[model samples]
Target: PDPTRAESKTVKTTCPYCGVGCGVLATLTDTPTGPQVTVKGDPDHPANKGRLCSKGSALAETLSLDGRLLHPTISGAQASWESALSQVASRFKQTIEAHGPDSVAFYVSGQLLTEDYYVANKLMKGFIGSANIDTNSRLCMASSVAGHKRAFGTDTVPGQYEDLEQADLIVLVGSNLAWCHPVLYQRIAAAKSARPAMKIINIDPRRTASSDLADLHLALTPGSDVALFNHLLTTIHEMGAVDSAFVAQHVDGFDAALSAASSGEVQATGLSANELAEFTRAWIGTEKVVTIYSQGVNQSTSGSDKVNAILNCHLATGRIGRPGMGPFSVTGQPNAMGGREVGGLANMMACHLDLENAGHRATVRDFWQAPTLPEAAGLKAVDMFRAVGDGRIKALWVMCTNPVVSMPEADRVKAAIANCDFVVVSDMYGDTDTAKLADIVLPATGWGEKTGTVTNSERCISRQRPFLPAPGTARHDWDVLAEVGRRMGWQAEFAYESPAEILREYATLSGLAAQHGKDFDISALSDLTEVEYDALPPQHWPLTKERRGGRFFADGRFFTPSGRANMLPLHHRAPAKPADATHPFILNTGRIRDQWHTMSRSGLAPRLNQHMAEPYLEIHPTDATTLGLQAADLAEVSSAHGRAILRVLLSDKVKPGAVFAPMHWTSQLSSAGRIDAVVAAEVDPVSGQPESKATPVAITKLPAR
Candidate 1:
């Protein structure tokens, strides 16, 4: 073949980092040194239109096979695929036989492809007769899911990414968009530059890079989002901004919700009267406004209530599901939305169906020919690890995530996994903190070597086509799940040939769910052949023949039993654990700009690591001085749960009584930088999502070594 022709081989895929779902073009060429892959933004994709963030641009550098687990292993010895699969099937079967299905659990992750998530959910919930399957998404977007279901009768995002650019005003709550979601930030920044009159409001406890573009920044008290939004709701009512006709016709619980909002004290927001007046005026004045939230909103003890408070403001003013108005949730992981569609959450069934709904459960059971299905939700992330620690869950399967480092009370989580009766970890790297404690380790293909699909934060499903070959004995996660399912004696149900076949089955089931009035309907693509599936383009959901992908609830029609949105009567609640004299400072944890979770992939790139080399703590200058600490000094931060020593970076960004730390470092990367170990295990009552942002802790400068 001609050199030019050979070098022209390129595949259009999706970024494996954030939920922005930016399209990527991976081009392969043969060089004298070896095979080289170059990745760039795909200009044809709608999500980003050729905009790539630092992490996405450095994708090619992370594909090296260094330190990769090339084959399956059992008890630190290499094992054949057949042997590993048989052992996994046998142990899981024996565990269920002895302790019932609830005794075994599958802890999956958002890094998995849609196909992988679907198979894992099916095998655990259908074949295994239990709902004990949960994804790491439980730690990020579960609050949004719970709030959506309570309000709309289903988990549905109202608007798309375009709303951010089209809106007259944008309210960002608990999100560091510039560092966490760079491409979306770039889009909003560009839109504002073009239309200078557009307004932006940043509401966060700490001043962040995203605040640079804000016309106003509200650094309110931590865990006070409900109070802030409640104040806004009452202000809208007083200003006569309520859409009376819309509320009367298409909303429920308005009287009670408004009464609750009226009772909330504006002082709880920790904002001055002038700031409150200015914020409410802009929000009530702008008819086209979008409220975007992320982990900062979701990872809280009152996360669900906080979500409803924001939704209440949008609903009261009829500013939702329209072109430039709605409450939008930006997921932290690439496939968190896809996992939601496939019932990766313990409380859900496939395609936005409720596990507690008898009719919905029956429909899925009949479609899958399942022997039995659990009628109740299972253990969530925090509870799952608790069960493991207490010996209630005997067998555990961890796939594609490092719970040992990422989970709250992580030291206990690490100890639980280490002492569990049996543990199986499926990942690309075997030496990760979690994998080191596993009884069995299964090698799996990573981003560039996997072929599947993922749904982004905006509900767009994009294909992730492979541009390189699998490194060694590694296999796709979907393939591994299917093989295990077959070994578990569900041959016919699990006899999937390819990712295309799995997508077809999932889509067909989604059609059944749509028949039951669910919001997730992608049945139009169920008839695609292998070639058609392989060449599928990025598209939005609700892809039926009559209606293609776009916004939901735009026509004032919701999936609720009463056909009206429900505005919850929410009251402001404080964080679960309050700061005391011993631990007088609250600890906030989050992600950094360059590093991804646990740094399995992003850490491999030296350029990415250069952004912020070591794990450090962000503290206010006043707090640093009060604690007898100086910049670059090592500080020991301790909570009731655990402690860590981090380099101190004194800045006024953080409040005087609060400190912030990134959650990316692990035991493998740093000796004592696993921040989650210091996070409390408190969770929201409704959503079961851990409260990661406000753990009470105490800090002191470490002595010289």
Candidate 2:
């Protein structure tokens, strides 16, 4: 190689962290010390145009093989891949034969690639003949999926990332983009700077970094998003901002939806009259608007309704599918969208097919050549663990996720996994709380060593190509799942020779779905050869020559049976568990800027720890004083479900009666900072998403302990 070309060995991949799906160019080089790799933003990729955040910049550092589970293990001892996988397959088979198929479950994660998710969903829902497979993503974007299906007749995101830049008015609700999605936030800031006339609004309980860019910040009451958006919908009607022609042409159930919105009390949102009026004015005045939401809107008992409330405003105003328009929901995980695409949720079938619809289920079954297919929905994340604890799920396989640390009422979840008859965990690290209790552990490749595709929040699918070799005895997650499927006697169905073959099959199946008038389609790429697959570029779905830009709803046509959008009647519902005299403070849990879920990957990078070395609680000064607490004071926060001890940091950012803690810390990282231990297991009635935020708790200073 020429001297100048010595530094040019690279592979294009996707970031494994946030749903931003920023393209990364991993360059490999040789140094006297050893091999070195550096990650830079892929300049040609559309999501971030050569921009990376703090966490993405440190990804190379996080990929070290230190403390990795280099080979499969049984009860913390090394085991051959064959013996471990054989035992897993046999145990799952025996459990199903004895207790029925429903007794076995697969609790996977969004950390998995699309290929891995595809195989797992197929095995549990099609071959094994049960819908007993659910992912940690159910905790992230399930509400958005439910809301979209109820309204659009399918789970579809209409606009692209460019919509944010083109939007004249950007409304962010329950999201701290500056910390969670730094690149997209930078894009919004740049867009505002380019067009100074562009306006922004932030609607959240805490005044976060995202609020800094907002011209108006409505620090509303927690779980009151429905009230605020319903009020906005009613005001839009009053102001004649409703798209009368669009309503008459393409919308249904407007009268009932508007009536429900009219019945909601604006005061319930905890916004002053002036603040409410200002928000209404901003919405009515702006023609080009985009409303973005995140975990804050999804992690609640009424999360689905909250999602609809935001959608109702956009739908009623005829703002969707075009540039600078529509309700935009960004996901927390890199493949949450991809997981949705492949039916990783309990209630769904592959390619956006509904498990409830016999025809849709048949379409997927026929495409998979499956002998049996599940008809009804299975256990969700919270319910799955409850089943595990109750001995309903006799065999459980958890892949690429740490449910014991991340699940609501997590301590109980850990106990449930520990007592399960058979438990298998496949991950890069073997020390996770989930892995510690597994009967069998499978070593799997991590980000830089995995080859597959991931979809971002914008519905763009990008390749996560491998630039480095797999470590030790590790294998790709998809390969492991595929091998197990072969052992389970689904030889032909799981006979995937490479990730490329799996992608082709998935694409072909998607085309079959599109032929049946489903919204998911990538048939144009179904004929790609291995070379084409390796050189695949980031592309949006429902792909066709006509769908070149990958945008949907341009013609006001939806995938609904009537080809019309359905406006659901939504009402505000309070959090399932309320704060009271005993546990008066509302405990809010979320991620910090530099850490990912359970800190499995992000924790490996010591540089990421520089941001926040330890977990602490964010309490208001008043709440701190009432609890006899000071900054850095040790506090024991107890809830109805569990308790944790966290260092206290008093700040006005939190509401007087509420405090916040990051959900990233785990048992391995901290002795008692796992906030999910106390988060109630309350779930949304419709979406089945747990209310991770707003768990009622009490705090007391720990007497200088």
Per-residue lDDT for 375 in model 1? 97
Per-residue lDDT of 185-205 in model 2, one digit per residue for the tens?
999999999999999999989
Candidate 2's TM-score: 0.98
lDDT, candidate 2, residue 458? 91
After superposition, candidate 2 runs with Cα above 4 Å error: 1-8
Residue 525, candidate 1: alpha-carbon lDDT:
85
**All models, RMSD in angstroms:** 1.0, 1.4
User: In candidate 1, residue 328 scores what lDDT?
Assistant: 96
The residue-by-residue lDDT of candidate 1 on 1-705, one tens digit each, is: 655444548999999999999999999888655688999999989899999999999999999999999989999999999999999999999999999999999999998999999999999999999899998999999999999998998999999999999999999999999999999999999999999999999999999999999999999999999999999998898888899999999999999999998885778879999999999999999999999999989999999999999998888999998999999999999999999999999999999988888999999999999998899999999999999999999999999999999999999999999999999999999999999999999999999999999999999999999988888899999999999999999999999999999999999999999988899999998999999999999999989889988899889988998889999888888899989999999999999999999999999999999999999999999988888999999999999999999999998999999999999999978999999999999999999999999999999899978
Question: TM-score for each prediction?
Answer: 0.99, 0.98
Model 2 residue 436 CA deviation (Å) reads 0.3
**Predicted model with the maximum lDDT:** 1
